[model samples]
Target: MYLDMPIDRATPHVVRESVDAVRRWEPRCEVVRVIPSITESRETIRVQWRLADGVIRETEVPR
Candidate 1:
C-alpha cells in the first residue's frame, strides 16, 4: 500500500487487510484492533492481539 496516499483513501482498507492477513496466518492469535498512525512521518500500522494462551502483543508494521 502507498503511504503517500491520503489516509482516508487507503489507510482504512490497508489496516483491515493487514489485520486479516495476520489473523489468517497466525490462527493462535485473536485480533483486537488495527490502527493506522498517519500522524507520524512514516505511517505505521499497529496490530494488537491476544494469543490463545492470553499473551498480549502489539506490533508496528511500516507501510
Candidate 2:
C-alpha cells in the first residue's frame, strides 16, 4: 500500500484487494460493498455482501 496515494486512487485498489481476498478464499459469497473509513487515524475497511443463499453479511477489515 502506498501512503502517498490519493484516496480516490487508493479506494478502488483497497476494494479490489478486499474482494479478491474474499473471493479467492471463499467462493460461496459475493462482495457488494467495500468502504474506507471517513475519519480515522488508521485505515479501516468495511465490507458488506450477499452469500449464495441470499443472506447479506457485513464485517470490518483492518488493513
> Per model, how many backbone clashes are there?
0, 0
C-alpha lDDT of candidate 2 relative to the true structure: 0.80
- Scored against the true structure, residue 43 in model 1 reaches a CA lDDT of 72
What is the RMSD of candidate 2? Answer: 2.2
What TM-score goes with each of the models? 0.78, 0.71
Return the clash pairs for model 1, or none.
Answer: none
**C-alpha lDDT of residue 35 in model 1:** 79
Per-residue lDDT of candidate 1, residues 1-63 (tens digit): 555787668877898788789878988889988878876456788888998788878999877
Writing each residue's lDDT as its tens digit, candidate 2 over 1-63 gives: 656886666777887888999999988879888888845546779989898788878999775
User: In model 1, which regions exceed 4 Å deviation?
Assistant: 1-4
Local error of candidate 1 at 42, Å?
Answer: 3.2
Which residue pairs in candidate 2 have backbone atoms (N, alpha carbon, C) closer than 3 angstroms, thus clashing? none
**Candidate 1 to truth, TM:** 0.78
lDDT of each: 0.81, 0.80
